[model samples]
Target: MSFYHNRLLEQDYYPVVRFYYYKEWEGFNMPNHSHEAIEIMYCLSGSCLIEVDGTTHKLKKGQFIFIDGDVPHRLFVEPGKSCRMSNIEFHFEELETVFPSFRHLVSEHEALRMLTESPKSYLLFHDSSDVFQCLNALILELDRKEDESVFTEQLLLGQLFIRMAELAAKQQNDTSEQHVYIQKSIEYMHQNYDRDIRVKDVADAVHLHPGYLHRIFKKAMGTSVNGYLINHRITKAKELLKRTNITITEIPHYIGMNSQQYFSTIFRQQTGSTPKQYRRESRYTDSRTVRSEHFKQQAK
Candidate 1:
């Protein structure tokens, strides 16, 4: 069974980017699945083809493809070639918060506007492009697996997004100066949600009062700060329940909730099922889908 995990920068709701570099020796077949993040896959070597919404795109060495979030896609390599690629996944909604100018660029520029407004399955880039360099560096940093500074990582991420956004804005484009106070609060909320964090704590992180932060977060994200926090925690809990073998009782602790009773109440309210029920239904659905696909492939 294959599942796609959405990785992000620890503690930030905005632009949680995950980087991966994979070398598939006998080639690989990633079954069709959809995710909530835009994915950029770059071929460092070898070759493969990606099928999205029934269209097949040939990706060769020195080329890459940017797939929009929530698009179902699958990848496969031809019989002889091995494949090495860098995969970057991130939420597109974070683009506006992370790069304040991104929305403007999308509105003003025709190519970028089209891409954003009506995203295709993917956009292709060549090795010589500036975006490629930024992606390559980010991948290398992620692969190192060390105690790298978050500031440095954020800078690189900012640079990469800026270049890609700006490049799309015209040719192809800060971290600190652009972030609004509410964005900072959102980041804090994301980072500390698994703790016993409160609105005051989030406000203090950005030097604002609790009430003021509440208003701003509500206006910006259309939910109260606490509401956002609970929603985020519930989302994380759902992911864990669906993807992991952890017991339902342990899930509350994992998500920083105080008790299983509260977790079950909230889970049932939000998802219309208890955690165990949800997990069982989800696993059953996945297995059925997998079996159906297997039969189809065999018939073909």
Candidate 2:
């Protein structure tokens, strides 16, 4: 008996799933190695470290790293710490297939294009989407190897790629948005620092809720909104004291404070000097500079 099959045509793009596994490690280390397949290591619990090309990245719970093909890397779990992770390794090959390839998908999805075209050898991301579920499903299907499993596996893999790409893109967008909001808040503070402005006024200018603005501002600026405002006022007061012969009592009003005593207390706390003492010291330094210049001109 003889068997006959149709000839396979060349495909522009097709993904080949090499292998995948879920593993737990404790104080386990893998030496640097490279493979032809791209890989993803997703942490489910605890944490681990991934060293790639001399840079070490801490992969905590819910985070994952996507490493490109032929990139040398290794995983290390510290002593007394354990990490559970799901990993999938895959590569592309040219073959006949009905499914969409990553190249083709990139044309339709800007996020996917960025993911594939990024110059970084590896990308780390925190997963908040269905990426884990899809990856687990693909692993299960691959292990089954039952009839019709191939189609299901391909579909799940495609979903996984799209999900991861979207997650990375969302993270980038969120970071960019936060940066813009922070810059706007700082600009608002600088512009209105000489007024009796409250945190709510700054929030209102940025169209953000006061509490939300406070959280992000502190996170980005390392100080609260009110703290930044007070610091700015003190800075302006210092400049006025040093460069101008402004009255010590009027410095508070110039910097938006009505109570001279309160201003003095805060200034002392920040600069370790009372306003009067600072003014006196500044004048003494100026007189010394003038005398030195006169001596130099006389010598010439």
Candidate 3:
């Protein structure tokens, strides 16, 4: 799978499953958005951070994040780092006929219940070899293009769904305590990103030593504490730059960066555009002068 090719299902397919492989992707900023399809995102090489309903899920290699349909989510990448991940989107209704028990389990199991009921709910699994193999095989089959064997595709899809259900059933006992610590730290970052926070601050919040936290955060998150923090802040900065009339100079301050120069440099490094450049060319704004004046006067 290359950078921009999408292997989508045809209209007559039993189920619509799309395979996407993005290679060495520079932080592609996707805003809070939603679709009617459930999405399973697998980190293939470099790490990626995804925010679903404002809670950030940091996924390194071999980790999966299951997002329910109609969930608002966004993906983030570290500045100057290339992230490669697989996004597999499939509609739940497609499985109604094939996997009736799976849907029953989703409604019956508490863990799976939250995933379907709550828009903000998601399931995360780490270091699952079976899940990884299933996803990898699906990608390979889809990439072949000529191997349009509906039977083979259906078999693989059944296997993948079975693996996912098995994992969901046993996730309660399979979750790692260390991974929980990392999640806590990430949640702390998400909640307090606007403050003058540091890695030590996050470590302290999670009750881990700074050095030990750095090691685990990198292993779990595939980026340093500062790297995640900066990317998180940059994400917020991007939101402000587009949706608000706030001047570029004031945008960084709103997102906790004190220096506009540093903010612009980091913003450009992550997004390939300066704050002003981003603001000047956003669909969020049709005309800038009116909004800019309104924001500036409101700030005053």
Candidate 4:
């Protein structure tokens, strides 16, 4: 007789849900505070305001906000108005596991990556999918505290993340004319950042007059096209410095800045670090991370 043997790996990575609750609030105001876990607050009925990083956003029924970790925010419901909300705060913990971390998932999904890495501290979107259902199911599963509930909770959480990503993608794909123009302009800027492009050029690319484009772009993006382009270039420079061995002098020209001095000034103004200093710090941090991981594996 012939026999085959197979090995099963133990699952060691799972999400740590700090708190999950569904509550009704009447005329309540929460002080601004921050936490280490990311939070999702969904409005089920009525409306409320969430002030994030000094910007106030209204979350109406069927709407939700994804607040990043360590972002200062507060909730408010006007005096005579009652709001019903479902909230969950959670973070991922990694041990020796076959499953991936949240960062790995973020890197794999473009919409998820954009939502998590956005410059804004919080993202608001209208839920049109099973997001609320999945969230409610997750809360229910977690409350069971049964052995099987662990696996069910993880599955529901994954579904919730996928649903949220779908909503975020839909929000970005807004079909309004102004939103289309702004998206097209932003895409054009990203595609042509290596070239010496201007606001007029972007306007022409989108078939809008410069003046009209300026008004709509600023209205939608909260920044002028020129300002956005500069910020984009700086962001690209930081990526190169952190991830690549490209020389500092070549980075400016590669990012469409003709003068290294000008690039340095802008970089310092934005990041408070020169190119060399930034690169050194990034490399040091990377090396330390590698060493830390190596030691962790050795311990395992």
Q: Is candidate 1 or candidate 2 better by lDDT?
A: 2
| Alpha-carbon RMSD to native, per candidate | 23.4, 7.0, 15.2, 17.0
- Could you tell me which residue pairs clash in candidate 4? none
TM-score of each: 0.43, 0.75, 0.47, 0.54
Residue 9, candidate 2: Cα error in Å is: 20
- Shift in Å, residue 181, candidate 1: 49
Model 2 / residue 153 / CA error / Å: 3.6
| Candidate 1 per-residue C-alpha lDDT over 65-173 given as tens digits, one digit per residue, 9 for 90 to 100 | 7777778898988777787877888653333243333344434555544444433466666545677788878877777748744444555666675566555444221
Compared with the true structure, the alpha-carbon lDDT of candidate 1 equals 0.70
Best-to-worst ranking by lDDT: 2, 4, 3, 1
TM match of model 2 to true structure = 0.75
Q: What lDDT does candidate 1 reach at residue 68? A: 76
For TM-score, the strongest prediction is: 2
Candidate 2 structure quality by residue, lDDT tens digits, 1-300: 000001101224555688888899999989889888888999999999999978999999888998887889999999999999999888765655577655566667777777766657788998884888888888888888867534566678778888988998998898789889989988998988777789999999989999999898898889998998899999999899999977989888888888898999999999999988888898899999999999999999
Candidate 4 or 1, higher TM-score: 4
Q: Lowest-lDDT window of 10 residues in candidate 3?
A: 1-10
- Per residue, candidate 3 scores C-alpha lDDT tens digits across 105-172 of 44455654543343335678774699888878987877885854455566676577667767765764
Which residue window of length 10 is worst by lDDT in model 2? 1-10
Which of candidates 1 and 3 reaches a greater lDDT?
3
For model 4, residues 1-300, the per-residue Cα lDDT tens digits are 000001101223456688989999999999999888889999999999899989999999989998877889999999999999999998765444444545555557787666655445677888874888988888888887766335556667767876888787776666377888999999999999988888999999999999998987887788999999999999999999999989999999889898889999999999999999999999999999999999999999
